[model samples]
Target: MRVLITGGTGFIGAEVVRQLVAEGGHDITVFHVSGSQRRLADVADRVTLIRGDVGNISHVLDAVKTARPQAIFHLGAILSTASDLDPSAAMHANVNGTFNVLEAARILDVPQVLFASSIGTYGLGMTGPHIDDLTVQRPLSFYGTAKLFGEGAGNFYRHRYGLDFRGIRFPGICGPGVRTPGAAQFHSWVVEECAKGRPYTIEVAPHTRVPIVYVRDAAAGVLALARAPRERLVQFNYLINGVPPTPSAEQLADAVRARVPGARIDFRVDPQRQAFIDRLMKPVDDRFAREEWGWNPAYDTDAMLDDFLAELAAHPQRYPD
Candidate 1:
């Protein structure tokens, strides 16, 4: 099957592209904006690279028409910080861009459309052990609001136009490569800081816990859902949560100390940053996705940390002091 992935050069998108390419027998074309090409240097030859913004409906439609992709993975969107700073841009990227992708899929008659939603949609005042699909979404930020809108839009298209849409509410995704400038950057920053043996500031408080997913597992989950049977997915806009492991600063520091003995980490609570993330930290339940698509995590906190340390060990230059 031929596939088209928007924002295919990003950290998470690149991981998805890597997995799709490795799966073989499927042709992949990545659509990215200017200056994003360098990020795809590793996979440029493996997949076709198209430069354009998803906000432009014509561009997206043209890409789909040109690629003739049976499946479309729309991962292009603005981050929390940028979204908060410039809400109009966020709206254009997250809201308008999503519409463009869905419209393109509708026009091209794409079989499956996978949209990347976030846990942020489940905003503040969520205090519980398990936040399942039934939980109401109370988005707090413009970014979250836009994501919620995207999900709703996709559902509308599915019901009215017979478009197959799947939504994945990703957690704090951690991995090597692009530096994701969002509320979840700390997930990867902690490892990068540890790799460099340098002291870094913690954005959120020590007790603040959020769901996290290894990049590889996140990529796999997207693919699985995209290919799942439509009958199995009764919910068009499904909220699939990745595994969330509570790794406070102390726990993360311990992990770092174990990997790089005497690693320095100064925990200075940033109230503003903490508030934004705290609003989105809720226990996630994924029984629906597990039963419907056999979605399971491949790595736990310990295994993830070990793998991160191993990757850093292999290339020390990337994380400089």
Candidate 2:
């Protein structure tokens, strides 16, 4: 399969690219901003990297036409912190960016589109011990709002045009090499910083809970969704809870301490930031994803932490202080 991945140099996109390379039979074209190949180090040679902004339809259309990809992974967006700082940029990158991808797919008759949505869609109103598949989306932030729009728009495309658009609602994705400035990103930041023997303070509360997925499992889940028969998909997108029974900051920090001895990880609860995340922190039921497309996480918190530390150790060059 020929694949086109926007934001292919990003955290999750990089892992998705690695998985595609490991599978060994696909031509991958990465549509990234200004051709930053920094995060795409290992697989850079294998992929055809194109410089383009998804916010610009022309840039997206050009990449799609050039790659002529049968499968498109639409993953580019301005994340939480950046979005909070300048919502206009988020609108441009997240809202318009998603639209451009859908338009390109529709215009070119692309077979499939795999979108990366966020759990943020179920914002402040998600007051529950558990968030089921039927929860309504009332996003609190500009970032979440744009993501919700993408979800609704993708579904519309699927229904109106038979566009094979499928999406996954991700939580706080944790792993090494995440440079984006999202509030919840501190979850991953703590782990990565600790691995490098650097002291760091988490901004969220010690006991605040949140959904999380390891980078590897996140990428695997997306690929599995793409492989499933479209007929099996009763809905256009599915929720994926990577770490169920969602771990707390303290739990994750404790795990990091246990793995990386002498690591110093502290915290202070920023009420504002914590509020936004807490609103979307309910236990997400991803049984739909499991039954629909055989999505299963390879690592639990324990397994994930172990591998995280090990990977950082083996590839210290990957994460510099």
Candidate 3:
């Protein structure tokens, strides 16, 4: 089956590409912006790399025609910080970008589309208890607003055009790949910094808790929903909680320190940064995804950190000399 993944060169998208290629025999096309980070360097030969913007209808239409993919993983979007700073850019990339993808899929009759939505869509001021599929989302950032809007558009496409749309609300995804710029950078940023034995300032308070997922598991969740039987998903969108290793910032720091002796961590809270991180770190239940699609993450917080350090340690040269 041919699969076209927008933002296929990103952290999660790169893992998705690896998983798909490892699974074998599927034609893959990566839709990338002109000068965006190209994380798909390893699979350059395996995937049909197409340069285009998901915000443009013609770009998407042409890619759709060229790939003729049965499934689409729509992972393209601006990050929380970037969106908050320049909402117009976020709107163009997230909202308009999603519209283009959904419209193209509707026009081409793509079988399934796994749209990437963030836990940030859960809104600001969430206190206690894990958010579920039924939780009301009062997004506090443009990025979240755009994601929520994308979910709504996906629902519209599904109901109006019979397009199979599946939305996955992801936690902060972390792993060894291209470093993404966003408010949630704290999750993987600290890990990378600590692994390199480099001192870094943590933007959030130590106790700030947020859900996180290893890139591999996040990609796995997407693939699972993409391959799930359409009849199984009665609900339009699925909120998947990737396990929060230990939401405490100190706990994450300790894990890093333990891995890299004498790793330095200074607490310097960025108010605006904290706002975005707070929502994602809020406790949210994922029983819906579990009951609906048997979705469960393979790594806990400790496991994720261990895996991350192991990967980095195995290849010390991957980082700057």
Candidate 4:
């Protein structure tokens, strides 16, 4: 398979790249901004690296033209904190950038385009024990709004142009090297800080619960959705949950402390951030994803934490404190 991945150096994108390389038979090309390729250092020799911004249509066009990939994994976008900080930049990078990718794929006749959407797409006004594929997406944040736009655009392209567009709405993607600021980032930071033998503070309350998927599972879910037969896909995009029972902040802290002995984790809830998290505490229902495309995550909480700590310890250079 000839594959092109945007934002391929990011936390989840990097994992996707590594998995593709390990799976073999993939001619991979990573379309990424400069200076962000640190995560690709290990697999630098295995894939072609193209430096470009997804916000730039010309860059997106050039990358698609150059790779002419069988599949384009569109994972590039400004995240929650950055998007909220500057809506204009997010408009360009997240909104316009998605348009550019879809346009490029349409013009170039790419067979499939996989997208990385988010659970952020569901915001206030959600009424259910858990959010499912059919839930109304009334995204509150700029980043969430942009992703919802991406999902809408993708559906348009798929119906209007017959493009094989598919997406996975991810929950909080937790893993090492997640430096991006967000209400849910503590999912990764608490574990990471403890792995480095440092005391860390959780900005949200101990009882706060946000559904999270380990980064590897996140990457794999996207790939699985991409690989599913078109006849089997009832929806163009699907929501995916990770692990089970949705661990609370206190449970997450306990897990970290258990793995990293003597790990000091404190909670000094920030009312503002807590409010932001409160809007996104709904557990995800990914039954559609599971039924449509074997979307089972390999790691439970213990398995995810064990692998995360092992990765941090084995490759300190990749995930520095």
Expressed as tens digits, the lDDT of each residue in 2-59 for candidate 4 is 9999999888889999999999989999998858577878889999999998989999
TM-score computed on alpha carbons, candidate 3: 0.92
What ranges in model 1 sit over 4 Å off? 124-129, 242-244, 313-321
For model 1, how does the per-residue alpha-carbon lDDT over 214-282 read when each residue is reduced to its tens digit? Answer: 877888888888988888886655565545566766677677677777777767878877876665666
Report the alpha-carbon TM-score of model 4 versus the true structure: 0.98
- RMSD after CA superposition, every candidate: 2.2, 1.5, 2.2, 1.0
lDDT of 3 at 215: 85
Cα distance off (Å), candidate 4, residue 15: 0.3
Clashes of 2: 0
Q: Pick out the ten consecutive residues of candidate 1 with the lowest summed lDDT.
A: 236-245
Ten contiguous residues minimizing lDDT sum, candidate 3: 34-43
Query: Which candidate's lDDT is highest?
Result: 4
How many residue pairs collide in each prediction? 0, 0, 6, 0
Error of 2 at 13 (Å): 0.5
Which is the leading candidate under TM-score? 4
